[model samples]
Target: MTVRPAWLLPKGQTREDTRLAPVGTWAPDGEIRTRDGVVPGGQPFAATGVAAMQLQIGVGRAAVQGTTAQGAYPIAVDAPETLNFTDGNAQFARIDSVILRVYDGLFDESEQPLARVEIVEGEATATPTAPTLPPCSLRLWDVTVPAGASAGVGGIDWGSALADRRRYTTAVGGIIPTGWGLSFAGAYDGQYRDADGVLERWNATDATWETYRAPEPPVETITGGLSVASGWSLSSFDARRRAGVVQFLGMFARTGATLPANPNIGDTLVATLPAGWRPIVLLEALCSNGYGFGAAAVGGDGKITIRSWAGGNNVSGIEKDTNVRISAAFVQ
Candidate 1:
């Protein structure tokens, strides 16, 4: 028989200075964040545009249902299977770190303390690298679980594989007064370690992170390198105003600039400035996009600003009334 370990690699009791989960992930075809539902815990979470995991869709009993005996069951159950990286489309994610926290239900399963968690940092290759594996060739971590809780470190292996992307069902026969739940800090789900550590949408209509997750004791992260000259800009229609832009400047104080909402005089717009990436910024406006989603995330406050118009008058071909809302967390 295989011996089980005692300690399981649990969630970080003390939150780190830097957030791990990807922020504001965008779908390849469009600039919209995914609402694919909360991804379950203790598994490798990855996707291109949004932080949603595929659903465990069950099948209906077919003609076999009537043919099989009512009380009879298959001697061996064929579990659900995943075609590696099949759903992998535009968005790709590398784990900042995976956290697996222990849980003990609170007063009738009210609150589950993040007792223990496992953190993993690894890059996910293309969901499907062409002829190689279709879309996303995601190979989950083949973790060898220990038998005894007393044999290992919290039932987890250090310097070893833990879990995978396909599935996670109960392994050992354990029971509790109340069960537990978890939260995934996908791109939109920013604050990995705030009081609650769960994700709350800032502008649901616009698909942006909640303002609660900005410059503070709990800081968030935005990848650099999303500026214009790179190929585009984002603007709002008229409703989602409070829009703005965040730039990713290197080693510089993060910055931001908002576009005014005036569609009458000129076509309100926020152009992506061709600048360095890294330090990110946030923008708020009517929330517009190229595909007419009327919203997108491009640059942050850290980059240089290209006002809708240069020189008091509309530039050679610029419009002054373009409006874009911008935002960011500022340390006091």
Candidate 2:
């Protein structure tokens, strides 16, 4: 025969004649309190401390008017719902950490249930009856965080091998949509790919994107070699080439003889133009005596013509030795 231990009895039950039963059924002093729905003191059973509490919630049932079962009984039981705690005071309650144990259908050593322990500082609003906990403050589901990194530091790794950041290093060889642009760095600094897959750069001054030029072409310069035409001798000449345009500045002199004041000078080759290029005169001058007056124009043969007049008309009483300089640009 096996002998049962006294501690094996159910709660509020005791051993009498070596048998555990209800409180009043076993002992006269153990009486069930009727008032206040509270248990009476001096029950002889006391717990040291509660280590854990397990609750199995029952499902509500419906009523059926059919055959034998009169009252409704639970037909199907739902999985336990998540427990919620609230103070309903509109204040906040903080929790330093929480440990959650997860299991499959049955929990046992063979099942090896998982233990998820979170150690982040979190708070819940304390309104009135039920408190509400906010969602996680930080989300790092796919983040590759360092081992020793702090919990506060979490983000998607931009330079990670998992990311396709290298796509911007060079322009894609495939076709792209119109007006689509991409900005990159390194060898492509200030450069971008246009909709046509063509590389370009932002021109802040122009407020637009210009075709990117690798090793920009050097500016071209041409020496006119000094040409004197129509009694006009070349004094100095300067020419500069930039992109698709060229500009020239030429000074001419036909002095050593006194002439009428504000004399009108005709047709002069301020400068010659390159083939297929036309010259657009910017400034024409005839500096003689104390004042000068001249006008420049583009001739039919791409030559710059300068004509001088006094007060908009031919004048008399001029000085000796006059200087004429012409500034013009040639564009193809």
Candidate 3:
């Protein structure tokens, strides 16, 4: 299929394309699939105002240089059942109306497109499978196993190619891309390998193997302007703002407001500019205890600017604006 590198929606809002479509907005016809009987009596799904969920790729961030480590992500929001009800007094919890907001990005080595997504469902694990994969990226039945039959959760082996880990022992509720909140990335895992990979959750005795597939996107070829097509490569970033973990994927072009202080000696560019495309919530993430850090923003248009603090402290010590040529799509 023809995959492009762009988010359908702006930050803090649902993508226009998803305004009246399924939560998995990027999924065309089929991209991934979930195991039958996996969700049990799949109660029809739907969504309306999804504006408070989180998104994240499920791959290890740790990797060698030259490529991103393999990872996984959910194109849907899997959550627990609410307003509980059932068939004829048999009140088994049921969940419905899970929505996911997705953003598209560059392709990886396997020609797979990276998708940043969010789910607002209660609780579910997003393996690299579908009812989630975009239409052009799936052929699910080709690897189907028996329904209701426990694979790794009970007794399934995912071969020896993947690292053996613990798996889940139950068929918990699954979500299909519901929610629109803060998220870390697109695609499932960061690693878009060119071959089969595996994921396992602790299942008491041993790690249960998950049934999934992968469509690795090619992350080669560094660019000049660092657009989505060029891959926004920032100069330096603040890991202090990192919520949990911090890893530098790539350097970015400088796009900050000129400062008045003399940063000639040792002024490392901490945060990155929205120069490539546009930044929604760009902030300097530090490696500290997630506190004592600072943040500021240029408008979505990115015309507003701020100079770095002399000592990297955003306190009310002293700040100065710059007289320089800046570019932004939106005005401050």
Candidate 4:
């Protein structure tokens, strides 16, 4: 049986053993198992245009997980590395990728456990696609080489050719970069990320990173056209909005000395909600008028109308000194 311990390299350890020692020492198990990309903070392997066929990669660091036996590896570019690309095809375009590669001698005798930056050339075709990355390689950028592109003849345009392929990762509970989600699927619910300065949480049920929004206090005092009818007076009123639904709560009392005759269906106007508080479609709700029950209709045009009433004398259903409760809700 082979016994190999990480973090501490014992005496007489070979170069290969030293290379694998830092695999688990640098990051936690969850991060090593689930994450592999450019490390956040400094400009990790940032590619900038240098010449028609050349790009300068800035100094940076990254982490990439190899096979189970090889484990994970930390790659660092201490100094900027300039790379050159082959001339583009005369008849068709191609997409080439700049990548950070980890070569393990255990997998291939000719290879050593060394991390290096290299370019993977793509095939020239009518519809050229980026080349498939080999195992233990992380793509940094995709350079689109147009037809007849060359350093001397019809120089390549670096501005339009370079497509950023750099995705970022960090410690297990750290905030990932903006485009990290596009390449990596969230492993569990409650995972958080930074999306272009916006804090977002991964919702497993929805399979998306929903923007985190602070809870807003409900509107205590109602506004807009809220005029009580001639024979009625308001006791209390308030409005609240939550999760795209607006709810109205209030109490109104009849002040007239005599009971009013039951008007036609949808006769009395109670209040008119503002533009944002109005519902997309007309909504109706059952309301209590102290002694009897009534139907309140909320229209799309922001009108609140008393539709009908039941109980009391057949002629006058609403009696004087009675209170009507306005308790309704609708989607805003």
Q: Report lDDT (CA) for all predictions.
A: 0.25, 0.34, 0.24, 0.71
Native-referenced Cα lDDT, model 2: 0.34
In TM-score terms, which candidate is top?
4
Reference-based TM-score of each model: 0.16, 0.34, 0.19, 0.57
Q: When superposed on Cα atoms, how far off is each prediction in RMSD?
A: 24.6, 28.9, 24.6, 10.3
Residue 36, candidate 4: alpha-carbon lDDT: 67
lDDT of 2 by residue, 127-243 (tens): 211112122111101112222223233321224401111011112232122321243222222534343566666555665667777886678776565435555567777777776
Could you give candidate 1's per-residue lDDT for residues 1-332 as a string of tens digits? 01111121134322221122222221111132221211123322332211122112111100000011111110110122221112221245232222222232321142543222222333344431111211111222332222222222232232342333332221112110111222332232222212234434434355544435444343233433334332224332111111132222222111233333232224323344333321344542322121111223333543333333222233232222333244332211
| Per-residue lDDT of model 3, residues 1-332, tens digit only | 11111233234334432332222222111134221111112322221111111111221111011112212122222332122111111222111122212233432433433432222222122232223433212111111121222322332121311121111111222222222221212223221111123332223233222334445443322222322212112343221112222222232332443323443212333333345333454433222212112222343342223333333344221222211122222211
Q: Write down the TM-score for model 1.
A: 0.16
Q: Write the per-residue lDDT of candidate 4 for residues 1-332, one digit (tens) a residue.
A: 02222222224555554453324323333433646677766676778888888988887667776665566666656678888999999999999999988776666564444666889999999999999999878898999999988999856788788888887776666777765346445756777778889998778898877898878855544543466667778787787777787888768786865445455344577666666777899889666765667788878887777777775544366667778787788776
Model 2 bad stretches (over 4 Å): 1-192, 195-216, 256-290, 311-320
Consecutive 10-residue window with the lowest summed lDDT within model 2? 161-170
Clashes (backbone N, CA, C under 3 Å), per candidate, total 91, 15, 71, 0
Q: What is candidate 2's TM-score against the reference? A: 0.34
